[model samples]
Target: MSWGIEIYEKGMPIKITGRSFIFDQIAVTQNGSKTYNNIPKGRSLAAYIVARNRGSYFTVKVENNKISWNSLRGSQSINGIIMVLIK
Candidate 1:
């Protein structure tokens, strides 16, 4: 908090940290999109990064109360993903 950006939640300070989760070990049909629910609410920004992959690509985004990862190139099956929440 000495330099750069600082975050707060309900008047409490927040750390710029991330959480990671893994994708199911199965086939995701080509050009398909999957939604992950029960994401934490009330944050300034929510973003994601691909952790690992097998043979597909992804375009990840956070919307409303869920996160969606679309197999933009083909059948997307990733090893894991990191969800970063910024307050």
Candidate 2:
């Protein structure tokens, strides 16, 4: 199994409900009320992006996307399992 992240397109509410499993433990950038998560090795930052601003829609540029992470580290059992629920 590869330690990585996943991205999805679903209703905005679902992202907030499942923010834990989606984000890593290190934020690389922060701007006012918005904080961007660090791009982890083998992990994409898409899921974390949506997880930040829950219940809101935003344009995510894959070439230059942002993320936000939680500073909680543990054993690498599961790195990414982001699920976007459809309404």
Candidate 3:
């Protein structure tokens, strides 16, 4: 069994811990940014890159509710898994 954290909201239990209170996966666009408004119950944001195309690098940015991925060093294309964790 795994352990996490929760809080009571008006006598109801609300899960707010473990593996990032909330997690969202978004696809990378060759160029541009995407906005996500479903804010999770947490105080931090974490992101990871899972590259699909060999020898491709990207610069990822998370600002407010926006996530942007751009090919770096003239990479022809950008393809990968953007793991977003709100915790």
Candidate 4:
């Protein structure tokens, strides 16, 4: 049995869109031990942020197929767009 989910079939880019408030965090976990290729490492994942609140910062962490993100700011709701390239 395999719990792995293929985010991309041809190693294409996937775009994810969401909204977040200050101090809000998001976590995405792949349901298997298999890891995707071309996944950014550690804080470098922030580079995948296509659009976010100005003056705000994003914290990203990737371990295996799990990804966590924290939106940092004092007070504000922001729309976040992230593009992930999977191989």
TM-score of 3: 0.64
Off by over 4 Å in 4: 1-47, 74-78
TM-score of each: 0.42, 0.23, 0.64, 0.37
Best by lDDT: 3
User: What's model 1's overall lDDT?
Assistant: 0.46
Put down candidate 1 lDDT per residue, 31-70, tens digits, no spaces: 3344545444644335444243565466666665444567
- Residue 67 of candidate 2: its Cα lDDT? 32
For lDDT, candidate 2 versus 4, the one ahead is: 4
Question: What are the per-model numbers of colliding residue pairs?
Answer: 0, 3, 0, 0
Question: Which runs in model 1 stand beyond 4 Å of their true positions?
Answer: 1-45, 84-86
- Which wins on lDDT, candidate 1 or candidate 2? 1
| Local accuracy of candidate 4 as per-residue lDDT tens digits, 1-87 | 323322332366543333211221332222212234554454223224445546656555565555545555534444554444332
Model 3 agreement with the true structure over 1-87: per-residue lDDT tens digits: 566765443467656556664467777757667777777545556555644467677877888777777888574777777766686
Clashing pairs in 2: 36-67, 37-67, 37-68
Error of 4 at 57 (Å): 1.7
Candidate 2 per-residue lDDT, tens place, 1-87, comes to: 324343444543433333334433332222212234454445444333434333233322333244323323332222322221211
- Residue pairs that clash (backbone atoms under 3 angstroms), model 4: none
TM-score of the candidate numbered 4? Answer: 0.37
Ten residues in sequence with the least summed lDDT for candidate 4:
19-28
